[model samples]
Target: MTTRTPQELAVPVRGGDLAVTRWPGEGPAVIALHGITGNSLSFGAVAEQLGDIDLYAPDLRGRAHSAGLPAPYGIPAHVEDVLTVLDHLGLRQALLLGHSLGAFTTAVAAARHPDRFPRVVLVDGGLGFPIPGGADIDEVIESVIGPAMRRLRTTFPDADAYRALFREHPAFTAHWGPHIQAYVDRDLTGEPPEIRSSCVLDAIRADGAGPIGDPETLAAIHRPEVRGTMLWAERGVMNEPQGLYDEGRLAAGDLSPDRITTRRVDDTNHYTILFAKDATAAIAEAVRTELKEM
Candidate 1:
């Protein structure tokens, strides 16, 4: 893989500046969005594989460098921040690629604006999961996220300490590499003895309940103008047998085959899917193919 240096810039948002990372390329521009707890660097591995395309990733409010931004943080706030990025970059429209929570935000952005994004590629998210009625939001998040949510409450002494903690995660143990290490390193902030993930728990909780629970987001999946592909990891977040969207769940979702194409990526989980070489290659190819069709 070719090594590319990413340029970091701060774009003005409502309350503060939004940090963005741009991987320069000559091909058509692609805007990449990371998961709820993830920073812009979460797209680093995939961006490396997509050498022909210019990639822009932002640290959404309440995560990483953008953590200080005031909230009311949720899908709508993220959508507005994304539009600010698009305007800052002078892009009238760009191909959108979002992973996990980012995928939910992408769908909402496409539906609300319709003209800002020409194509959207949802990576391991976007389709609403089945949350039993009357289930507590906190419990739902705990069940779905498991250890990740627990880590948010703990503080690590340093980046190495944080990295060691993640190394123990089942989904990443086998595939742990420099890319994942760098991603984890960049996610940590604050001085030693107080260092922890930059993601704000409150913001995550709000975002979890907002887009995933919104009926309009599901309806956006069927919008004719909001066309894209949904990529599903065969494994779940913890490398479990069942993924976020299993075959049965996908078949029952509101997604129309004519609007969105769904494909399963083998041997990947929610977090590792974008980091895997084969999965990243497939994602990049899908973006290129969609851009051509447009």
Candidate 2:
């Protein structure tokens, strides 16, 4: 692993251009995807630990620098952007790593273009949770990512105020530091005393109606040819006692254990599992170990 510095990039997408953070490395090429409402820096903590691979993380359309990207935002659109990014870089293949909503995107991309991604690493998301019978998918999407959606709609009086919003969040408060600070600052736009998240509410809402628990997501984790590791947090998004998935839930999910190996990251929540130092180190190790195994 080497220094993980942000090298900004802008690649054309459907509606407009998409911004990317290219962290150069001498080893393999890694295309990382951040969670919904999160910018590319979400992988800052973990990328810093892996000094060997070329890491490319994009601000998916409708978030951060890509927020201006137009309508028709959803998993399908995201998949197109990911492929476009690869083509723009002339990368025939690359290792895939995604967090939260990004994880879901990674899975589908890998499934659709296995030749482009031999394997992928999913952190805190990727698997589709079964929606209740007769439940409105829109409402369920709202419940799943409501806080992030709300924050996108919120207005902060100042940059400090914007940072305060995350400071109060249980996931980052305990692990706050420079990297987290960078991540927070990158998500803000507008002027001082009028700051707010860069994420677009419409884009997020459209993606919520995306392939959550859909056949695409399930195929990513259940296909016999699919291979990767799923790093789950012990705690939930709010840092609660239970997380999105547990041993029992995983066992009952009808996953292809032989294909996707699953493990729990102790004392971590959905956010920390990808950004916190220890958790990020674990993620770095997972990527490295798999590289060696492959």
Candidate 3:
């Protein structure tokens, strides 16, 4: 399969607009969704690893290119935005792949619009994280990754700097390659100065950390028509033992196997799972195998 460069797009959604990127090809369409703060570029490696098809990756309303989305960015709203993109593409059904925050949206979309997609892949997200009886989700996310989240405010002087920074991140070091470089290329814009990145901090937090998660939301995800599979990083911030320093992710709670067939990929962390060669191969093979069954 040949990998193509990403093209910019703007699609209308309920709250405002969705910033989208497409890699055109001939075959069944596949909609790839990014996590919090991530844009269409997030799916670069997965798209390359998968079949030759029309790929659609959208930056949800509140993040990346579509940073002006209104408040209260919840699951329902995210599902609606996905629907809007499908409608805009004139596709009644397609494969759905979502990561982190995107996974939550994917589950909600498949649940709400059972006929809209035939297969949905959850990339280590959307599970109901353990929450105290009355604790605040936003506060929790902020406290856990405060420094990293705050760094979102600092824009890179150039793509090289951004790439170098990402390379240094424990998540991207081993995974940085052509696909990642291509993905980061889309975020560059400027005159001769060449400013880097299009992500917005407030928008990401508003959308990802806002709605949080509850049993009701998790239970609400039940899409029989949409074949479901979840891919998780074996060793990462999201799947570690609970403790004072731990992020309190995997330790939160276990998921019902009946809903999603989960798989653990070795030698990958949350961020690298979508890009690393071995990790991408695992995800692609799983998706292909599931689609064939469907």
Candidate 4:
């Protein structure tokens, strides 16, 4: 359909390349990191909401056209990759906006190198999840995000399927109908059937559980300069409200609120919050507020 991020730059990192799209505007640069199984388009709606601001959204390694990134997906590696891109671009500081798994990655980066990013926003994730014992990463995925992933796979045999699928989601039903539709439209290809989706199934699987890395490692990181904020879907299946309530209290004992903030997006769920109009507006406001404050 329409390409909002046209200035695409391929930056090589560790094991693969990141397909980064830069949109120039006044103000400090903003880096948008998509969730697992997602690409730069994940921030499409939110980007528009931010208006005239320098934006950089990257297709993380191994996802979509950014294939062949290093395996064993972990936060440290992903953060380093982003650093390489920043250095290559000569950006001294940036505002990081990450969703789902990408949120966790941004947390690691901000915590590890606070100087790299002065402001950060996590859109539904970073607090981590609670799974059953003896559960492998695959099992966790199947139990949590698999339904949406599979639904996307089956619904998008064509362009209409993507729109139809988003329409069906309880979270995005009343959101940016056109923008979400456009983001999904970008994946369209082939004739006869015209299927779409740039997501790499294997990459989704590999990058699954590694973002959690080690709690001890996360605790040890202290980035005083980084001011962080989180936007969580109230009805998220993964980091359910009750769970985050508990995790937040615990994280507070270790992490400072001045450094991190978490706000719940009401009437939204994990799958739909990013596209939901009101939710996206809230997300944009949160990011803008954080950046302005910083």
Candidate 5:
């Protein structure tokens, strides 16, 4: 399949302009939301393989170019942003896909606004576990994503220096390429000798407490009006043997397979499931299959 350069645009919202990336395609429009710390380019590799639809992903507020956008930054804020994008584009309804925290965001959005985002494609993160009784939310979140939080605070001298840092990340060690490289580049901001991540510290903190197995999220998957497809990876962010949702966990979590469909992409970790060679191809094909039915 042939790939094309994506176009970037800024959609005005309440706090600031939301940065959006559009990958031209011939099929139905797809609106994708990235992970907590991820920007729109997180879907670049998937877009390369997916050529049948117009794919759009946003640099969610407090991330990448939208980093300048002010507070009110949680799942609700993100849901509002998603709706604004839909309204700005004049889309009554479209395919809604989300990865990582984005998966939860889409779930909440589908549950709250079924009229706008009825179709859902979830990647490796829609399921949320309840925090143990009396657990500290900040501590729990930090434990879950400590390294990323540290990376957000650390400063790099330049782009290559930052790249070297991520190159050492366990998740990308096996197969690092342009997709990973671009993801790294997009995360870096500020001038040389003092470059830092574009993701806002506060936003990450706020959203970390946002969604996970909440009532709204659960409703998104079980609701009759929403059609949901969940894709699971074989490994996790650290390329661990057990992924975020192993078979047992998935079976336990998904009580209603009738409303929500689940599938696995083998030889892929949570991060690679979106961009790695074979993984991306599988994702693209699954998307094509879904669009065909629609």
Candidate 6:
């Protein structure tokens, strides 16, 4: 159970460099994608459990260290970025695992480039989210992301102050361990009184609004060529009872049973589904099983 340190590398893209964090291993490679406000380090816990599978997670353009990159930010742009990462690593194909917004990106990538990703795993996302009727995209983002959206506009006096804010979040208060701390710490940049999250608000807006709002992009999950599983969290953001994918929603039959399978991880929220020990173990086991089949 020793955790391996991730090696930070930069891959060239059309706009600029894409910052990647790699956990080296020997088995089939797995490319991970983080959430809207997340960075490559978001996969730290999952990587710790994946003993023999190589994992490459990138900070999508306009997030974390890749924040400097320009946009055309949306699902299509993110899909191309994933392709660039695969090409840069000389990988013909890899298992795709995406959490939250990353899940949306994963589905698009799998559909757009079936040869590049044979199997996909979505952690707490990828399924289309329900936007209440008459709500604008900004309202939807505000309601869904809540404090995270507010944090993007606020400047913390210091990194500790920023951590304090997240520490207060119901989702992280119990599961806030080393991995989560490291992920949050890496999210902050600049000096005191000016320190802010590395995620660019404009990029998040485009990414958050585009995939969830697009009918065609969300339909990618049902594509016959795209095979995948979705691991859902029982709790929603802030540890609320309403998760992103509720029982009713799952039973609603939006996803094709022939292409995608869904499973729920209990006692975890959206954020912890990929970071909590038991939850990460489940994700790791699912990943190992998928690789074995491949």
TM-scores for every candidate against the unseen true structure: 0.96, 0.94, 0.82, 0.80, 0.95, 0.96
Residue lDDT tens for model 1, 1-294: 677889998999999999999999998888999997888988888988888689999999999889999988988899999999999889898988999889988988888887888789999988886565677776788777768888889998877889998898988898889888878887898889888988898898988886446677656666777788899999998999988888898988868888798999998998899888888887887887777755
Evaluated at residue 179, the lDDT of candidate 5 is 78
The residue-by-residue lDDT of candidate 2 on 1-294, one tens digit each, is: 345567999998787889999888788888999987788999888888888688999999998889899888887788899999999999888788989889888888888888887788989888876665667755676576546666877788899988888888877789888888888998899997779898887787677655455666656667655578899999988787888889998888777876788889998898888776678888988888666645
Give the alpha-carbon lDDT of every model.
0.86, 0.82, 0.68, 0.67, 0.84, 0.87
Model 2 residue 283 lDDT score: 94
Quote the lDDT for 109 in model 5.
87
Checking candidate 4 for backbone clashes, the offending pairs are 15-70, 16-69, 175-277
Position 259, candidate 3: lDDT: 52
Clashing residue pairs in candidate 5, if any? 27-52
Q: State in Å the error of residue 49, model 5.
A: 1.2
Regions of model 5 farther than 4 Å from truth:
212-214
lDDT pick, better of 3 and 5: 5
**Best candidate, lDDT:** 6
Task: Find the number of clashing residue pairs for candidate 4.
Answer: 3
Q: Work out candidate 5's RMSD over C-alphas.
A: 1.6
With candidate 1 superimposed using the best TM-score fit, by how many Å does residue 242's alpha carbon deviate from the native?
0.9
Q: For model 3, how does the per-residue alpha-carbon lDDT over 1-294 read when each residue is reduced to its tens digit?
A: 447777777887766677888887776687888877567787888777776767899877665577677755666667778888989988778878888778877877777677886678888675654456566655666654333565465666666776676667766666678777766665554433455455555555555543354544565444454457878776554323322112244444444556567777777777777887888888888777656654
> Tens-digit lDDT track for model 4 on 45-163?
67667777778888887665665565655556678888988997888878888888787778778877778876788877666534445677666676666465674355245566666
Q: What is the overall TM-score of model 1 with all chains considered together?
A: 0.96
Model 3 C-alpha lDDT versus the unseen true structure? 0.68
